[model samples]
Target: MTRKIGTEEAIKRWNRFADAYAANHTELGDIHKEVFLNPAIFSLIDTVKNKRVLDAGCGEGYFSRLLAKAGAAVTAVDYSPRMIDIAKERTPDDLPIEYRHGNCEDLNMLEDKSFDLIISNMVMQDLADYEKAFQEMHRLLTDRGCFIFSILHPCFITPESGWEKSKDGKKLHWNVDQYFYEGTYEQKLGERENMLFFHRTLTSYMNTLMKTGFMLEGIIEPKPSEEMLKKYPSFEEDFRCPDFIVFKLKKR
Candidate 1:
């Protein structure tokens, strides 16, 4: 069994992998982000025009740039200083984005009830203490504000889940195991880098969200659109099982 590491160690690994990770991200983010996450996230969000938006785990700042381009006053935060630097380098001077280095688990520098919308795309599962992150997101939102986030589907993307291949190396049905296990595990991200991820059951996620004062508004298991299919034919296999899940939650 792999030993569990905390959020700081995870961020340190991210810092080391930042350059290679950022290399994969374009203005629309990587292929997975473009094909799966962006559409679902945008569909769940309200108009960003003139809104005070927080890209809670902004990554390389692609989504933050999108929000800013759509007229949002965006404040983007990332746990890794390298990621913050990369995000700043990528962002244009005219874009309404302020990149900050901060962990999602506790964002004390940000004032309470200051944001109109908070989006953490594909970020929740990466942090060690997502419950505290959820609470911090709740604290950062206005009374009527909403929070949107995406993660590997807790039901399907467990620590011991992947495709079961055939004898001839053909992909078969997906496999899932260790669904109830909750802690840090290493997953390969690059040739030399293993990223830490936290696993939680779907029930745990929902319960924690509720406990953190969020009202579940909507959920989406995104599939590739026709346009996306035309761009990447291999994504057709993704229809068989969901690899990601997006949630839209409102402050109660």
Candidate 2:
């Protein structure tokens, strides 16, 4: 049986790996974000100008900065103190953003229905209590407000999923297993540090959103655009299978 990790352990691992994780992120985020998530996320939302935006689980706050630059009033929050500090330091003096230390499961500091839109990039999987996080997000958004998040594709990125590589180290088919297992699992993020991620099936995610009173707006299995593929040819491998999934939900 896979041992279930608590939220505190998850946060501790995040705090420890925060610096190394942030190192890979630029203003556009890592290669995966640059190629897949950003496009899918931005496509779902309309204009951000003069909107109230919440960057839930906003790591180093790159997306928050982007939203601020685009004329949104941005409030960014992260569970890790180190991440919050890095976000503040990385944020320029001009971009108006509020950085808060808080967990996505319970953001009581921010009032209910306080946001026009909430964007959580590559964050949901890292959370241990995703159901609570969903409820919190529902509470945070105004009526008709949107909540957009990206996570690892639940069906494909399972605990026992990886490449079935050949002996010569040549490319091979992607393998997936244990799709029904839903709990915390440690995944290597850096050379030594292992990060915790909670895996739930796609049905669970969809049903949870419905139960939380979020109307399903849209879903995207992010694929690198032609422009992105031109810039990063290696991402052509993404055509074989999707690595990420983005969802747009409206608070109803």
Candidate 3:
């Protein structure tokens, strides 16, 4: 049986792996973000100039810094204290950003209807209670405010899914199983640490957002653009399957 882990345990693992994680991230947030997520996310949203933005689960705060540079009044939140510290260190003193240590599931420190837009880059899957996090995002947004987020494609990146390589280690098809299993699972992040992630079905995610009073605006199964493939030739393999999904929702 897979051992159940709570939010506290998850945060502890994030704290331990914070430095290693931050080491790989730049202003664009690692290679994956640069190749896939950033394009998808930026394509969905309007101008950030003078917009009040919240970066939920702002790991290392690269996205927050990007928002600030793009002329948004950005507030970044991360549950890991070490991660917040690293984010602060990376951020230049000139970039006006508020780095707060808070969990996405419970952000009472931020008032209701406080933000015009909230972008949670690759965050929802890490939380133990994503439903509550969605509710909190809803509460934080002004009327008709936009909430954009990205996560590993729940249908493809489940606990029982991976590559099925050949004998000579040639790439083969991706395998997916146990799609209905929704709970905590251990996933190795780097060479040493195994991070905790909660899994949910695609239907569960959609239904939860609908129940939280969010109007689904758009969805993107990120595929590397031709420009990205030219820079990172290895990303051509992404054509075989989507590794991530982005969603744009609005509070109604």
Q: Could you give candidate 2's per-residue lDDT for residues 1-252 as a string of tens digits? A: 255677888899899888998999999988898889888999998999999999999999989998999999999999999999999999999999999999999899999999999999988988888999999999999999999999999999999899998999977999999899999787888776788889999999999999999998899999988999899999999999999999999999
Worst 10 residues of 1 by lDDT: 1-10
Give the clashing residue pairs of candidate 3, or none.
none
**Model 3 poorest ten-residue lDDT run:** 1-10
In lDDT terms, which candidate is top? 3
Q: State residue 11's C-alpha deviation in candidate 2, in Å.
A: 0.6
What is each predicted model's overall lDDT from 0 to 1? 0.92, 0.92, 0.94
- Which regions of candidate 1 fall more than 4 Å away from where they truly are? 1-3
- Cα lDDT tens digits for candidate 1, 228-249: 9999999999999999999999
Q: In model 2, what is the error at residue 123, expressed in angstroms?
A: 0.9
Model 3, 214-242: lDDT tens digits are 99999999999999989999989999999
TM-score of structure candidate 3: 0.98
> What TM-score should be assigned to candidate 1?
0.98
The residue pairs that clash in candidate 1, if any, are: none
Error of 3 at 14 (Å): 0.5
